[model samples]
Target: MIFFDRVSKVYPDGSVALQNVTLTIEPKEFVSIVGQSGAGKTTLLKMLLAEEIPTDGQVFFESSDVHDLGKNEMNELRRKIGMVFQDYRLISGKTVYENIAFTMEAAGKTDEEIEQDVPHVLELVDLSSKIWNFPKELSGGEKQRVAIARALVNQPDVLVADEPTGNLDPVNTYDIVQILKRINDIGTTVILTTHNKGIIDSLGKRVIVMEKGKIIRDDKQGKYFI
Candidate 1:
C-alpha cells in the first residue's frame, strides 16, 4: 500500500511540479495515472522512489515513511519497489540474462539464487528465448519485456511504470499492457502512468487524473476524463 499526504514538489527555479496532493493506493490494485504533458505524474513517481524529496508533506510505502529511512534502510526499501521507464534502461553491454541478474546481485543475492531467479522471470515475460542476447538486438517490445522481467525478478512489492508504452506501436503496447496486468494478477501493486487513452479506458480500474500540479480526480473503475 502507498499513501501521500499533502505532498508538494518545488524546484529551485521557482517551479512547482506537484501541489498539496494526497492519495492512497491499496495493495494489489492496478492504478493508472493520466494527465497531459505538463502534469505532475513523473514528479509524483520520483517522490515515491525517494529519487526526489518533497518540499512539504510525506510519502509512505506500506505505512513506512521513505524519507525517514537511513542509507542502508533505503537500499533495502528499494528492493521491495521496482521502477520501469519509457527508455527501457538496460545496460548495453550486458546480455538479457545478465541484465535481469544485475538486479538480484545489487540486492546481494547469491549466484545460486540468481541462476534460479533469472530463468523464471525471463519465462514470465516470455523472453526466455533471448536470454543471451544483448539490448542492441531486441526490438522495442522485447526490450520493454526485458525491463518488466528485471523489475519483477526481485519479487517487488510495487511496480512503477512511467510512460511504459511511449515508444511502441499499438500491438506492442497491448502486449506490454497484458504483461503488466498479468504481473498484477499475481498480487504486486501496479502503478502505470501513460498518455494512451485507449489503454487507460480499457483498463477500467482506479484512475487518478492530474493537471497543472494538482490531482483533480480519483475514481474507481474510472474513465479517461482528462
Candidate 2:
C-alpha cells in the first residue's frame, strides 16, 4: 500500500535524517519500525505522510507518488492516512466526543455522520464511557486511546502510530497494543514505531530495525533485536 523507493532526506546544516531507505508496506499488514533515538524511524513515517520532502528518490502511496502531489491533492491523500503520536495531542478543552468529532467536522462530515461514527469509534478504542470526559481527567492509557479513536474517526487506509505506548505503564501498553492489533485484524494497515522491546517481541510481526538513518534489518515474524 506504501513504498519508499531509495528515499533520502538531508537537513539544512548537514544532517541526514534518512539515507537511501527503501521499503514496501502491503495492504492490511501490521509492520513495526524499531530503532533508538536518531535512527530515522520517524523520518520514514514523515516521508509517507509527505510532511518532509525527500532530498532524493520517491515515495508512493498505492501507486501515486506522494511527493508529487499539490496542496489540494496532498490534503486529499492525507485523509487516507491516520496518525497517532507519543503525546496524546488532545485539545484540553474538548471532550472525548468532541475531540473525535473535530476531525470528522474538519472533513465536512455532517452532524448525523458524526453522531453515528463517533460513538462507534469510541467503542472500538474501548472508551465509550469516557465520551464526556476531558483530556485532563483521563489516565495516560485513556488519553492514548482517545488519540487512537480520533485518528480512526476518518477510517484511514493506514494507521501510523509513532511511539503510541511511550508514556504508559506495562498494563496500559499491553492494552494499547491489543487495541492496535484488533484494528489491524479488521484490515487497517498498521505502521507502528515504538521503543519498547516487549511490544516488539509480543507483536511477532514484520519488523524493520533502523540504525544511523538506514534500515539495518528487515524480518518477517520478527522479535526485538536492537
* Best model per TM-score: 1
List all candidate RMSDs to the true structure: 0.8, 1.0
Candidate 1: stretches off by over 4 Å: none
lDDT of 2 by residue, 75-114 (tens): 8788889889999899999999999999999888999999
lDDT score, candidate 2: 0.94
- Model 1: lowest-lDDT 10 consecutive positions: 120-129
lDDT of each: 0.94, 0.94
For candidate 2, give the lDDT of residue 181.
96
Model 2 misplaced regions, further than 4 Å: none
